[model samples]
Target chain A: MQAGGLPDTNQVSTDPLRNEVPVTALGEASVETPTRAQALLRKIEPYLYLLPALLLVGGLLLYSVAHTLAISFTDWDLITPPRFVGLQNYIDAVRDPTFTRSFTNTLVWTGGSLLLPVGGGLLLAVVLERIPGQRVLKTLIYLPAILSTTVVAAIWSYVYTNNGVLNETLRWAGLDALARPWLVFAPTNTLAMIVASSWRALGPSMVLFLVGLQTIPPELIEAAKIDGAGERILFWRIKLPLLRPITAVVVIMSVIGSFMTFDLVWVMTQGGPGRSSETLAVTMYRQAFIMWRMGYAGAVAVILSAIVIVFSISYLRATLKRSAL
Target chain B: MKRYSNAFWPLLVALLLVPALLMGGSIAAQDDPVVIDWANDAAWHEAGQDAVGEASLGVTGIGVNTVIFTSTDTYQAAVRGALPTDDAFPLFDWWFGYRMKDLVDAGLLADVTDIWQGHIDKGEYPASMMGSFGFDGRAYGLPKMINYWVVFYNKHVFAENGLEVPTTWDELMAVAEALKSNGVTPFGLDVVGCRWCSFIWFEEMMVRVDPALYQSVMSGETAYNDPQVVAIMEQWRDLLDAGYFSQPGDFSDNWEAPFVNGDFGMYLIGDWWTGSLERAGFVAGEDYGVFVMPGITEAGNRSLIIEGRPLLIAANSPQLDVALEFADYFMSVEAQTVWAETSDINSPNLLAPEETRPGHLVDLANAVANGEYELYTRYWEATPPQIVEQVVDLLGQFVLDPAALQTVLDGAEQIAQDYWASAGGE
Candidate 1:
């Protein structure tokens, strides 16, 4: 009934079709609703059509977000009803060394996840564009994308195992010392997982870059060639700038994927060699599900969600500006 | 409009009958069988399906749905999520010990005491196993199998190297030094990234130190930083530093390759590997053999670690009636013989005579029957799940680098203290 500050809906004509033709009322041409009930119906008709859908989507989303935020302030195992302990969960998370390690690892994961996939994808897209067996190369590289995360993790971990493919290759080449257990130690452990994930991620990113590459007109490249511009100059000055928008999207997706990563890391190392390879997502899952500390887990989830939102907003703003240009 | 109304009546009738038709169809389907869902790890999917099929053979109007997950961790994760809901499977497989008790306390498990008591009355299972699956005199699960840890050595290799099954620490060490001197890896300690199995030698070393201490430690009565625990670490460090172990990889089934080729000599692993060793083409009691791990001294204590897998029924399942029927059949001697043959496991069913089981399995069964060794539950499932998860990593790390023993042990102590404190120092 309050309708906020919306314009005078009380004047709405229930007989919308009939009211478009002006009726002479009290010496002036004006529209009129014969009844208050009819006017009210007209005012609320659009809302009636929209209410079901809005309640379905908006209500669900609002409840989920509010519930998550509320849980972040409490201490609950998944089995027990949450008990209010405002700010304690957050404070504990801040002081926990494991959380700190997980955060740092998450940053490392995000950085690697973005740079390698995006860079490799762009390079592959350009190189394959001119190559003869382009279809085959792209198909082979992209095939991993169709495989499930479980399959990819399984295959890659086998490759990284002590006597697995990589080590065997090194041994066959007589470089025995070069083949350390790629997944058993830190820095190397995280890097190895990144390589595996990048393999699976590179395909879709390349497809996006390929689409962006198609948007560049051939005449520009021909013109650059006529001006004695080399391939490096052509890419650095013209093509690279043109690809920024697609690149931003790929980078953002990769970063988001890194922040939300759980499957491959879990399959490969289970975030161990003593939590050395744990990203925030893995740590959060271990706390909530494995350790049964749902509230603390919720706090970590909020922190992760905040990081993702901030990055997404900044990237989206820049992308929008770039598109506008 | 007149013609359309004529058509509309038939359509309306059909639409109205849809619900009735569905109800009738579901009723017809229900007449086919009562469905019992069995959730377990995919590693045993075929075995489980086979066992269920064999068990269901004389029973009528029953069908079992086997839902197998790829791994234990993922399966446990899914089970935990599903436990609080009515949509959970009626029957699932899990490790028994403190974990079972935890669920029993949480009121998540069904009271399977009737089936358990029936099995005992039939003398199908031993009292000890029933004890494992129960707390406060109410059983929650049925024991599937127990895997006894023993030192499996290549009989041919041992014969060729002029070595005997060592029965004391001195002889074991001398044999290991001899194997190393001969350029053969003495023990296959390969557990690259896998958990739970990495603690085999750790358990061996602990029980060797003092079985009572090991039991107390598992119960949280003894701390990880205890001097006896420190002694276990020092001894483990000495053995590891001697370069007596094989090149440790993620050796799941690949262990066969080195064992057959004689590059790997002995492995103090669970009886679960009996099947794998057979698969590796080793003739039991001829080409390969099992020996109890030697005691620490010439005259001292010795113990046997018994690891069992249990099948539980979810309390919230609507199909619990059918599931209980299935579980009863699963625990029978008739079912267990087929189960033992099909899955190549030593089922703990006492009614399944020793003569019917595999030779290597019969050996341990006889030992248990003779009361030749003291029994202790496996440390992996005997203690708290969280503590096991934390310490297994540290134990695995110690295998990689023995110098970190003290640091790892101290860290384990801190984790234990924190966990137990938050658990109200249980």
Candidate 2:
């Protein structure tokens, strides 16, 4: 069998208890060949073990996706029965100013995710590798990641309010001009939410990178050092290249996560100040739940899913090709 | 691919079918008591469920099961999602007017015209109230509770400032000026937490300025940026510029301590707010007093903005007769009184006893009943919900920054135009 795949159960085991067919029982009973029904049952036993998970994934996950796709081609408000409208909902989405704004904001959020969470996380991981009291520093830096997203959003909202701690501190330091309500304005509102999201995401990203750094062979670094490689050169030429697999995982997660961000934005600004801070997910939620435009929301969901799927496929293909070397 | 054993497909299907069959259990047996599931969003009234259930059960053979949702948004979503299926609640609370009209138009709500007419004939409910819950000459709901929009003020602060409740447009402005001069914020504006609160002043002032214009705007006959509406916006701007309003506060059902502690001299809100104040330990008529807002024009005098929710019966409910019987009982004065007392809110029934309610609410109810004031639906319920939701956000922005008045007004007009045009009303 391939590495990490299921074990080769056809092989005999030295331990009798561990063997699927007991050697003693076979010898003592002078076992005859199994009947067709018994052999068939034996062949299907492994599949029986997999049935529950298959059903759950098929019944709920696949059904929901298919249902959403079907609904996207219709016009439906919760109050009225759905009417097939071809590509009308998607057409409406394309023409909508709010949808355009949300799409742009979503791109901005993704960029922010790349810069703050992924970049900062790597920087933190590298710094921790050379720092004293590394364990304490690592724990402290990773603390916020363990919090629930809603709690993080709520805490950050309090910090961003007009009279909240951030503004109060600014006022105390005579930076009164900077003390505007951080969550009530457009780009600033979106940025503030991104910062909150990054704070929560940073810990996990840092931890992953730390694990990646540790997995690097110390002997390779020693050889590079012996060949006169300095700290920066060692990291650039050797350590960074070795961390590609973990980096791929982190980047993929951050990309999909930034695309699907909703709860933080919803809790903090509700995409408000007149839909100024809305991302695509926020727009989808508002359309479906608040406006009761289920079909339009389904279209938004489908578009979002298509984008994420495309990104995932292209990213995995590139990363896997590079990693295979 | 190698074909699976013959038994595999059937086994998989049966395993999947087991859960589906369990979830879609057989309908209740004939001997079971008809349980009427009543979905509501009023978390505060959860304690009163047993009393309400007992009262309704005595009148109808059905038992009541009140399911209280966390918030209005969730409740609305849940009710709409469940209405088409057998899992639908037999009854639920919903907003009146345009909000209710959506459900009525979809043929989801049971017709209650006969029950309404019966109550109207008995003089238990006013005939005029029927229009709010009716469409195409058919009533689809019964009023669960009603609240009149009134200005509640701190009596001690008013007395300290030597001001009485103003009765005219000029007098009200003068009172506000006096309160401001005395170093008290003239109004308590709650817009942050309770999103719907942002529409209160807009609705209140619009009706006060010109009730006809307000009605026209709501009906899509007049643009929100019409010159008349601009004039009202200017008046509101002047108040903001004069610093007559306090910083916006979060106004949940439990957050009445700010107003009770004299943070603002007056608060213009629905009479239902009295419950919050009372819960915060403010005694009605002694600690505070209520007054109907005076008109900006002569047309505004004695005009009150009213808001309420109605209890609707699902058309496809299995216990249709029992649900109807309970609804009929709900319309009776005794049932209304019990519900009002238990919930601590005003009942829609005109003949319900008022002794149990606060003195201020009782007086307002009397004034409304005696035709001392003309009633206009609250803006939230008066206009299409889709427009209202977007417009309220604009209104909130305007509240935070009065300089955005023109932008806010334009945005509102656009939203209104879009909704009206799409609905084929314009």
Evaluate every candidate with DockQ and list the scores: 0.22, 0.28
| Cα deviation of A244, candidate 1, in Å | 1.1
Tens digits of per-residue lDDT for model 2 on A47-159?
87797899999999999999999999988886677999999999999999989999999999999999999999999999998989999988888999889988898788677
User: Which regions of candidate 1 deviate over 4 angstroms?
Assistant: A1-88, A127-140, A143-146, A168-177, A225-228, A322-325, B1-36, B42-65, B70-74, B81-88, B111-124, B136-138, B248-263, B277-283, B297-301, B316-330
lDDT tens digits by residue: candidate 2, B331-382: 8887787887888877878888778566777777777778787789999988
TM-scores, all candidates, are 0.83, 0.88
How much does candidate 1 score in TM-score?
Answer: 0.83
Categorize the docking of model 1: incorrect
Judge candidate 1 at residue B174 and give its lDDT.
90
